[model samples]
Target: MPSTEITDDTFIRRYADDIAYVAQQPPATDLATLAAQLDTVAPRYEAAGITGHEDLETASLHLDEALRATGTDRDAFLRRAHNLLRPLVADMTQEYRLAAGD
Candidate 1:
C-alpha cells in the first residue's frame, strides 16, 4: 500500500483538529464517522494489521509536528488529537470485525 500522504500544512492541521475533537467525546457515532473517513486515506493500515494504538502513535508524531509548526491552541490541539485518534480506533474495530467475519 502507498504511504499516507498527509503532508500539506492545511491537511495536517485539519487532521490534527479532527484527532483532537474525537478525543474529548465518549465513544459514539462520531467516532464511527471519523473511522469511515480515515478508511479513505489509509485503509492499508487496517488491512496490514495495524491497530488503533499503532495509528495513534503514528498520528501523534504528525500532530506533534503540526502543533510545533502552527503553535496550535491547547484546547484545539487536544480536540484535534482526539478526532485523529477516533478514526484509528474505529478502523481497528472494523478490522477486527471483518477478520472475524462479521
Candidate 2:
C-alpha cells in the first residue's frame, strides 16, 4: 500500500546530506548525474511550496561548469550550493511543522 504520510522531513534531511556531500566532494565527471540526483528531490520541494527549483537547476549548471573549468574551486562551489540549499531546507522544515501543527 502507498504511504499516506508525507515524508518531507526525511527527504529534506537526506537531500541536505546529498547536497552537502556533492558540494564538498563533487564527482570528477558526469555532473549531470549530480543534477539528476537533485532533480529527484524537486517534487518534495514543490509539494511543500518551497521555492528554489530554478536556483538548483541554475546552480547545477554553474557547478558543473565550475567543476570542469578550474577543478579546484570546490570550496567556493560548496559555499554557493549550500547557501542556495540551506534556506530551502529550513523553509520546508517550517512548512512541514506548521502543516503538522507542531
Candidate 3:
C-alpha cells in the first residue's frame, strides 16, 4: 500500500525557520511586531503536533515581556527568547534531515 502519511509540509518546520530569523534580528528591531508575528503562529502549532516540551509559547511570552521591559530587563527577556528559540531551530533542522533520509 502507498504511504498514507500526510506529507503536508509541517508548520513546525516553517516555525523553526521563522523563529530562527526572528532571533537573529538586531536589538533595535521592534519587539511588538515580532510578538504579533509569533501570536499568529500559536494557533497552528497545536494542530501541527508541536508538543508541550517545545515551549514555543514561552518564547512568545518573553517577547511580550521584552516589549514592556527596559534597559537590562528588556535585554534579559530578549536573551531568554533567543536562547529558547535557537535550539528549536537546530532540533527541527535535525528532524527534517532525518525524515528526509527516511
Candidate 4:
C-alpha cells in the first residue's frame, strides 16, 4: 500500500510487512489464533462500528485482553495488528485504483 497525506509511506509498508509476518507466524500459543479467536474481539467492533485505522490500536488492545483470557499471550499483539492491516490493504488498494481512474 502507498502512503497518504495522513501517514508516511514507510509506515504503510511496515504495516504490510507486519501483517504478512503475523499471518505466517507459528502460533505456539492460542493467543495468536486470530481467526478462531476473533469471535470474542468482534463485539468490541460491533459496539464501536469498526470505522477506520484510528481504531486499530484500540481494537488490538481489546483483542489482546480477549487472547489473554483464552490462556495465551504470545501472538495477541501481532494478530491484532494483522487484523488491522487487512482492511488497510483493501482501502489503500481501492484508493490506488481510483487514482488510476478505474
Report each candidate's C-alpha RMSD, comma-separated, in the order given: 10.5, 12.8, 13.9, 14.0
Instruction: For each candidate, give its TM-score against the true structure.
Output: 0.30, 0.44, 0.55, 0.29
Each prediction's Cα lDDT score?
0.46, 0.52, 0.53, 0.42
Residue pairs of candidate 4 with colliding backbone atoms:
none
Worst ten in a row by lDDT for model 4: 3-12
Report the candidate with higher TM-score, 2 versus 3: 3
Kindly provide the TM-score of model 4 when superposed on the true structure, using C-alpha atoms: 0.29
lDDT (10s digit) by residue, model 4, range 21-95: 323443223333433233332343334344453545454565456545543343444445555655653554344
Mind giving the per-residue lDDT tens digits that candidate 1 earns over 1-102? 853333234343445343333333322233333333443434444455655655565555544544455434533554555566646655555555566566
Evaluate residue 23 in candidate 1 and report its C-alpha lDDT on the 0 to 100 scale: 38
Give me the runs in candidate 4 sitting further than 4 Å from their true place: 1-51, 56-71, 100-102
Say which candidate scores most in TM-score. Answer: 3
Top candidate on lDDT is 3
Candidate 3 lDDT, 32-54, residue by residue in tens: 65555565544444454554334
Overall local distance difference test of candidate 1? 0.46
Query: Which residue ranges in model 3 land beyond 4 Å of their true spot?
Result: 1-29, 52-54, 90-102
Q: How many backbone clashes does candidate 3 have?
A: 0
Question: Per-residue alpha-carbon lDDT of model 2 for 10-40, expressed as tens digits?
Answer: 3334355445342444432344455565655
lDDT of 1 at 102: 61
**Which ten-residue region of model 1 has the weakest summed lDDT?**
20-29
Q: What is the lDDT, from 0 to 100, of the residue 70 in candidate 1?
A: 48
